[model samples]
Target: MKIRPKVTARALAVLGLGALVLSQAACASPTEPGAATTASAAGGFDYTDARGDTVTLDTVPHNIVMSEQAAAALIPYGIRPVGIWGSSTPDMSGVLAGLDVSGIESLGVSYGDVDVDKLASLEPDLVITGWYAGGYLGGLGAEDAEVSKQIEQVAPLITVSAQKSASASLDDWRGLAQTLGADVDSGTIADEKSTYDDAVSQLKSALAARPGTTAYAVAPSTQFYVAIPGEFAELIDYAEWGLDVRESPIARDSTSGSFSPVSWENAGDYTSDLLLYDTRAWTTPLAQVERDHPTVATLNAVARGHVVDWTTDATFNYASYTKQIALLTDAVKALPASE
Candidate 1:
């Protein structure tokens, strides 16, 4: 039977391994603090983020606000922001579930639904969001110009790139953590880096033994949107790490978010050795996604039961991806050897 991802206590308990990796990160060896944490004549802290915009802070900017994705990265490093905005209502199934977020203010449930008044009242010094193209692209940042203006006025908004390779994003998060005064070399942050490296190594070893295995990523909803894996940070990292992530049958021109919408009848048009289905909400069972269009079963991966849960919609952070990659490695190990 195909398993559906549910937001239940049991599901979280199964996801606890990732949380364990994060909870143990705080004890790694410490490194020297970055200049951002020390006093400078500039009278504040400054950083050039993924968008290449310079965000300056009057002081160490203690009260922080961010999109839930950014919070996922910062929280494990002990840099808890004061407020968070999620794509949906806060739940225990999210990347931030392992940590206590009760004290963190919730801006709104979905993107474009942020409470500008409540956000401003938080009196935040810095706001972190996801970078798509050249601007903020997640949560409140995804709102209209007026909404963005309202939030920007309250605090400077910095973003990490959501379109870069996962490895790049991981490096950016490490830099961001240090800039935010986190001891990146010590604690859970450092431990996560080590775990991530080991996971990647394991993935590489598995792939090396089966170099021809191909994988395709898809987000299945009422429609099937087959992802061009290279376009996503995580998928790109997987490809570069030696997985045969294939390109899309049809190319789309959108930046950052791009996918080819396929009818169920043609779902098997793009098939591979493995099928990585999106794990976000709205994703139905593998059978249901191909209900009317039985042609999906013709896909090699599907016929061979090679489907795996892909966390493309979840937050991109070392702590999150470390666990994700480890799971992928395990999945690969479980696959039968090619003839």
Candidate 2:
């Protein structure tokens, strides 16, 4: 039987104390191969994950399993996970969309649907998930409490927090990659970072030239819904980088990254200079919105040809973020200035 670590009252205290204690825990475990060496390159490794849990192993993990988003960020960093879970299909617009995942086994599409028998066969030494709420999110264990227990039977786990802005979450991914022996100074990484910086600059310039331009993000299926900028990670990053992402009123208890459902007749209520149609869902595209919904067609943004595709499926990494920034910049530049 695989033995789990005993969590003391001190470890529980760490979580209650928040980020300061978490940072200290990280400090306690040096990532370098040769320090005072409780865990070394040849021996083992220890890391304080986003949840303030210290996950230690007898040896550094080679076979790993990951959530889809974690796979997106870590794959480019040269850490190919053995298995991935929680994506319905290869998201064509996602950051990892074009990546060749032929070698990686699929655990299943959604969070609670992993093939535990298949998962066991992989013999994963580590399982990486995204942190949300009081537990890990976006993997075999997240949506099901029983699944979390089952996952614990297979391997040790750690979570990279996705609770913050996209940029901050990317930083956490980078830090995790570094701990996993990625060369942060590699030429590939450097080039991607440079591209990201350039894209940000381009976006800033475009937004500056088109002052007072505002955008409303929406998904139009059978029902129309308006996105609240603060609720979505990518939208938060865009707003921070000078894009005016208009917020729709959200219920206090509503899910994060979810939009407020609205009637087609009320679509005109959230009018803005730009209409960002969510292309990630199986909804009506902006091109077809006018023919299907007369109310949406009457909006100023749509009439002026200011509608553009939006993807919340972007990977929170330099390469993916840079591409999105450039796409947004190009879309904004094509728009005519409002009178």
Candidate 3:
């Protein structure tokens, strides 16, 4: 979910993934640093998560409760969760777009607002979510010790790292889904993987064709927030794929370090050939942003109409990223070569 520069403490808990360290009260169990793994022996379920804590159960967990991001990653692999909690409404969730969530129960519609009673009613066998660098669990407010403890009492919790490279994160999710008995080898999945690979290649080719065509990704709000490429999986992927995704001139003082809030007057400080605007964060039309923040029009990209909608909260699955990569590739191809 997009993080607002000004939001409630509860909302901040979810958005502060990069910088918010897990509180002792928020952790139900101790964590050790290790590579994530999934193993089953004698029909017992054992999965070591990003935090290196292994959760064991007598049987594979079928009744699962997941954070929105986790549900998006697993649902494509045919592993649907029984319930989900998210930072935004399901209909508005960019990560959950194109995925069917018709019957699943929504534990919460806002960040860190899970219905503990409803979550417990599901009698979930496990609770899975995305883990951030600072031990933060997606959708669970780390600052809400009582809620975290209550949720912990309901089921075993495991996490897949959200901070990893997009491709690596997708692999981790696939491994988790396989462990949960998903048909990862199904034709549908194979086809999507092929499509994703093609999309990646297309993106690389587009970048190669437009060498030095710089771009900056940003979310427009009351105060503009420039994306930090290193903190985001997709941005990191783009840079690695050869796109000149520019870093913000502003420092990373925000709670998450994922974005740095700057005044509109300073938005032009980091000029680029293309402006990848965060469509998920700002729902209004692009013209509205220009009208609201006159300074936005001063940027060369804005003046040249070289802006593209960037989905910052895209799902980590190949299917989701295939579309995102394709969109970015199209944007790259549309840009004029450096003067």
Highest lDDT scorer:
3
Q: What's model 2's lDDT at 142?
A: 51
Candidate-wise lDDT, in order: 0.68, 0.70, 0.74
lDDT of 3 at 95: 78
Q: Write down the TM-score of every candidate.
A: 0.82, 0.82, 0.85
Candidate No. with top TM-score? 3
Candidate 3's residue-wise lDDT over 1-339, tens digit each? 111121112222333342322222112233333232343345556666776666766567788989999999988888888888996766667779999887898889877788877876677777888887666778775624567766665566778887868887888888888878788876788899888989999988889888887888887776677888887888888888887888766776745257877777887686888888888754445788789877888898889878887886784788888888888888888886544
TM-score of 1: 0.82
Tens digits of per-residue lDDT for model 2 on 1-339? 112352222322333343111112223443322112244445565666666666666566778988788888888788888888876643432547756666788787765777765766677778888776445466554534777766655666677776667877777788777767788767788789788878888888888888877899888886677886776777887788777898766443344336777778888787887788887757777667778888888898888877777877674678877777777888889877544
Estimate the overall C-alpha local distance difference test score of candidate 1.
0.68
Error of 2 at 256 (Å): 9.3
| Cα-based lDDT at residue 185, candidate 2 | 68
Error of 2 at 124 (Å): 0.7
Off by over 4 Å in 3: 1-40, 89-92, 253-257, 281-284, 337-339
